[model samples]
Target chain A: MRQPIAQGRTQKLDSKRHASAQEILDAAATAFSERGYAATSIDDVADVLGCTKGRIYHYFRTKGDLFIGIHLQALEWALEAVGPTAERADLGPEEKLREMVHRHAMHLMNRASYMGPAQYQIEMNLASEGRNKDEQMARILKMRRQFEAYYATVVEEGIAAGAFRGTDANILVKAVLGTINWMHVWFRPGGPQDSTVERERTAAELAEFAVRGVVA
Target chain B: MRQPIAQGRTQKLDSKRHASAQEILDAAATAFSERGYAATSIDDVADVLGCTKGRIYHYFRTKGDLFIGIHLQALEWALEAVGPTAERADLGPEEKLREMVHRHAMHLMNRASYMGPAQYQIEMNLASEGRNKDEQMARILKMRRQFEAYYATVVEEGIAAGAFRGTDANILVKAVLGTINWMHVWFRPGGPQDSTVERERTAAELAEFAVRGVVA
Candidate 1:
């Protein structure tokens, strides 16, 4: 966040403000999750951060912008979690899927805040329009398709290798991804029944279920 | 829609109007799925039905009531689909779970309109307040629990009979149900690549995967 000393204090302040975009996004994600995206506003996000709306606007132009940022971050996390497994040449399709599902389950379970808004991006897309809606939706979709394609590719490989039952790779991908994505909606941390370790065990079991679904 | 002749023509008209409640709910479900619950209104639902707002108002007291009614109806459909499988004494737990999941996936996929809104009841619950919110949410939660409890019972029975793997039954139930509930978001009928038979096969495969997850 440091600007060249010769440039002046004003530029340093601006850079510092820019660096706080993540903080704004984290606050916005929480607000959107607690209060549905349509009901939440810049004021609400600002209120949560103990800042003015202008502070939010410094980073995001609109509520849609914040939502898109949250989604992009979430997609990045999901891709980051599974991309390595998908790309590894040493792993077969079955192992690839197992690792991908395991990483994704952990990501979704651990980052519960971002998953809700990211999963509900369809509704968020509907709530905004004419303000880069086409570009934003297209980009989000591209990222989502990339994420889903990883699963589809692995499923196809599994089928070819005779490790998985032959089925429509696309639909099979959805079924497996759905189980992973739905983690945040139900799995709560520190519940009497759901200790931290129990959540980890459940994540492993979920991966097993998803992998087993396609595996012969 | 019949009324006694002695009650006159007015009574017949009232009965005819009363019978249209299901039509209103159906239209509302479609509108809600398309425009989302918060964006949809009585006028939107009526417009879809090619009727006036008065027609919708006569049947539903508010949009919340209509949303709740749609949720209840969807829940009823889901329960109806899986209830018989749960009750069958002839089938073992593994078979019961397989049949129940197969029936549920088909129900969710076939009733895509209702399932979208029903699965999104969390957002709907957030949108409305003070208008039977407690009663409606409680009833919805109760129905959902009953639905989940059915899965839990079968998982327990499966484990007891040494037919399935030992795991956290509650967590296993959530994982399976999440996959089933997520069907509507992605699966559609008669896509260029997806046929009716293909959809059925995917449903069966999902059941196979879910049942295999728990089975020893």
Candidate 2:
């Protein structure tokens, strides 16, 4: 009976620690999005969580570790949002494209915490690091290629199915992704329109343009 | 006779200073492009120039000032290449578009030193800084908007003359600019094929795609 109680306590403690780490990640994402990666510090993240830097250090070994972790989490969120939609075998090419576009735009506008930082890191930080920065960057680039490859597959399949024209799949994918990603540079949170509505409209327009551009 | 000698001496001095400043800016652009705005330092720029940090400080008041100067010079190079093409009223929309596309691609592929770093600063580092960063960003944004407006006018004229379709000029401009700007992210120097052939092919393909997309 005593052994069972000790095991239960340990499991509970482990779950609590996991939850704390997630909480810290959430706080870090918000801070990074608002303040940027360079301007933000571990202490700022801790302060936002009403915790101490020690707690962050307990979960993340270093500031770079925390940043890389945040980058990975954000990439995961983006992949989860669009990956499954693009991979659905039952949907026709056009339908799949529309759904993917909708989900991607919505994710960028609504989940700015994740997508915003991902964009910042990719567009800004990746090229700025030195030789010592290769390991972290290599991991990030691998994940990025995976993400881009998923889109490229969808584009190629669409063209093969006669849904899209015979333009270069690589270039078409880059164009589409560029339009989608560039939104982060210009998107404002609370301007004149509802964020969701604006994103939906923009996504629909871009999807229509891309589909028409590639259609037979 | 004294006045003539004094003028000659001043001209020689000015020419030497101009050459030195140009060399420093070139080195600074490479360092900032490779290491990024925040990660790069005056010492690094000086080392690249085979000089000391004091020499860089003599030319640039601060790192920020140097970055801003490099940014402006890069914009000037791009404008010099593409601006004149956009201003020609005699050419048809398709022809004009073709010229713009060709020149823009050539500029990017050849002048990667200036254009690459300029792109990095505009897309990433501008947002990474604080409120003080806004002035520089605003200048960049303004120039970008002007460039877009130039394309929009061409698009509108093309549509009016029955050479193009009446798509949303704003969206079309964004698509074109986005595609062009994204080249820096993936383009490499002497990686695979001849740069000129690759750029020409890309420009032709993109122009064909854009024309088809916008035609009624």
TM-score of chain B of each: 0.86, 0.82
Q: In order, what lDDT does every prediction score?
A: 0.77, 0.70
Fraction of true interface contacts that also occur in model 1: 0.44
Superpose all Cα atoms of candidate 2 onto the true structure and report the RMSD in Å to 1 decimal.
6.3
Q: For each candidate, C-alpha RMSD in Å?
A: 5.6, 6.3
In model 1, the clashing pairs are none
How big is the positional error of residue B36 in model 1, measured in Å on the Cα after superposition?
1.3
Candidate 1, B210: how far from true, in Å? Answer: 1.3
Candidate 1 per-residue lDDT, tens place, B34-142, comes to 7677667678788999989987766666667787788888888988999888988999988899999999988887888898878855553545356546766777789
Residue-by-residue lDDT tens digits, candidate 2, A1-216:
112111121245567776777788789888877766766778899999998998788776666666666777777778888899877899887778767766777777777776776764554555553456577677777878888887888888888988887868877777667666766655656757666666687677666655655666
Question: What lDDT is reached at residue A58 by model 2?
Answer: 77
